[model samples]
Target: MAQDIGRVHVIRHLIEKSRDRKIKKMIEKMMPILLVLAASVCIATTFGILFTLVFETFEFFQRVSIIEYFFGTEWYPFSSGNPSFGVLPLIMGTLKVTIIAMIVAVPFGLAVAIYLSEYASGRTRKFIKPVLEILAGVPTIVYGFFALTFVTPILQIFIPSLKLFNAISPGIVVGMMILPSIISLSEDAMNAVPNAIREGALALGATKLEVALKVVLPAAFSGIIASIVLAISRAIGETMIVTLAGGAMPSFDFSVTGSIQTMTAYIVQVSSGDAGYGTVIYYSMYAVGFTLFIFTLLMNFIAHKISKRFREEY
Candidate 1:
């Protein structure tokens, strides 16, 4: 009876091992299919958005003159009799805010990144990095309100000409909003430089700052530029901050103190029940959105080209 029990246990063990192998093989086969399905979903969603934007924008151009829309300086889509659809003013407003944001974000972010990557102790970096990332996660609407209420008031004391709802305040807030992207990406890029290069520079009598600036900065140049480009894209696409703080008036003026409207702000305004469905104003939103998309796409393309051209291999 004991011999018979041992034989039976051996047989059951072999069966369980075979069943485990079959389950493992089934999982391996299913993984590829699951990954492909996920990719397909993303691709389908992108195409759906593109199709919607293109069709509506094409219809808008049929009704409105494309030449006027592109080149005209005025943008009064709500005008009772002759609603001018010149997109130039909106473009200028966007550029003004973007330029201001870049000016504020680049220097401060780069400085923080350099310090974090090259100078900070591990414990300090661990604490500060999370704080910076948390800043990035703060709701943009909160930034807008902060710009509208707090920053604007502070600026008014320094620049009496600054309007309550102007480009400068929101631009500064937007800069703060995008600071984490610059800091995190630039720091990562700087850290990716080989320690051997730093050691060699140090052995040659270079100071810590010198090695960081000359060796690491050059090696990470592409990444820093890419981060800046990404920040610019984020600034361009930001809506709530500009809409709430930058005012609703679309102006051709480039003054930072004056009120102006960005493309995203205009979209929000029209979509807020002011423009009826299927109206020209409604359709114009798609045109502006497409234009914004083109700008961001162009920036991304440039970033990709720059990274490819200047990427350094270890």
Candidate 2:
């Protein structure tokens, strides 16, 4: 009877193993199809948005001169009588804010990342990193209001020339908004540097700073640059902060502290039920949006290229 029971148990174990193998094989067969489906969804969404933007933008160009849209310095598309469709001023404003944001974010963010990656104790890092990254979850509208009600007031004390509503105020707030992304990405990259490399450098009596700045930084350079590029892309696409703190004047000017309207701000202005449907001004918003999409797409492409080129292999 014991032998009969052992035989039955052995047969059941074989059956279970065979069933597991069959299940594994089935999953393997479906894996490629599942992955293809996932990739197709992403591709389809991208093409869908591109098609929408292109169709509307082509319609916009039919109502406005492409050359004027690209080269004209002033933007007064909503003027009661002689509405001009030039978009350069909006472009200038966007660039001004983005440039200022990078100026504030890059050096300071990188410095924080380095300190967190190389110097901080494990307990300190664990405590501080979450606190710092919590900034990412902060609503952009809050940042916009803070820029208007807080940062601007502080800046006015030091630089009395600063305007109540200007590019610099929003730019600073956008920089703060982008800070978590920069620090998180850069620290991840720096942390990915092998312990062996640090040990190898230290074996030669190199100082910790030297090891960090020279060995770790070079290895992590690609990720660091990618972070900065992403931060720039993030800044350029921002709307609420720029719309609230950055003034609505779409005038092409080089003054950092002056009132200017970004592409995003202009889009908001037009979309606020100000422009009638099917009007030239309404179409111009699509054109401006397309321009912004292309600009951000180009920046992301460049970042992808940079990170791809310099990706370090272990």
Candidate 3:
């Protein structure tokens, strides 16, 4: 009887050991699969948002004529008979704001970045960097008001045709809005450059300016250019400032003195008033927004490619 009990205990112990090993193996295998599942969920979420935009845009296009949507000269939704859906004017307006913003932001932001990275002392940098970033944190509506009430009047002094909601005012304000992004990003790139590289240039008797302009700047060119592109994207997608300060006229004229409508401004225009969802006017908003999203996405892709291509390995 004692021998029988011993044999039974041995069998139970072997079964328990096998079960534990199988459970351990299963857990180990599942961990990697779980990680993959988490990553897939994140990617799916991103694609889902994009898919929502695309699907709505498709619905919009099904109702509206593509020719009218893209090439129509006027964008008066509530005006009398057949509404003209030419999106060219809005595209032109968006380009005007983006170009003006780049013009304003690039030079000043780069200069600030150069100063902060190459010239400023640690103490000065500590003081100035935060202040510059504070510009980024300021509400866009405040900038819009500033442009409307302050900058527009100032611009009118130099150019008489500048209106209350001219492209110039909003463009400048949008530039200001993106300036911090450019400055902060460019400064980070410049700072990332190896100290040894700077020191080597200096050792060769190059002036600080020469080292900065020739060596450091070129080395960090990818990052600087990426920053500029990002700034342009921000300018292109700006909503509140352009909507508030820019005139809603969808004119094809490239003049900064006139009020022009941007894509975002148009979106705001369509979404704000009495346009009900599922209507042609309301659906048009999705189409326009999808176009704008594509533009920004392309810009981001270009920036990413440039950054990846030119990334320096230390």
C-alpha lDDT values of all predictions: 0.92, 0.91, 0.89
Q: Which stretches of candidate 1 lie above 4 Å from their native place?
A: 1-35, 309-312
Question: Which of candidates 1 and 3 reaches a greater TM-score?
Answer: 1
**Order of candidates by TM-score, top first?**
1, 2, 3
Q: Which pairs clash inside model 1?
A: none
Compose the digit string of candidate 3's lDDT tens values, residues 1-314.
99999999999999999999999999999999999999899899989978988888888889878888887877777676867777888999999999989989999999999999999999999998789878889999899989888999998999887777788889888999999999999998999899999999999999999999999999999999999998888888999999989978988776888889999999999888879878888888888898899899999999988878667544
Deviation (Å) of 200 in candidate 1: 1.5
lDDT of 2 by residue, 59-108 (tens): 98897889988998878887888878778889999999999999899989
> Local error of candidate 1 at 181, Å?
0.5
Name the top TM-score candidate: 1
Model 3, CA-based lDDT: 0.89
lDDT of 1 by residue, 1-314 (tens): 99999999999999999999999999999999999999999999989989989999998998899999999999999999989999999999999999999999999999999999989999999999889979989999999999999999999999999888899999999999999999998998898888999999999999989988899999999989989998998999999999999998988876889899999999999999578878899899999999999999999888778767656464
Q: Following a full C-alpha superposition, what root-mean-square deviation does model 3 have from the true structure? A: 3.6
Q: How high is each candidate's TM-score?
A: 0.88, 0.86, 0.85
Clashes of 3: 1
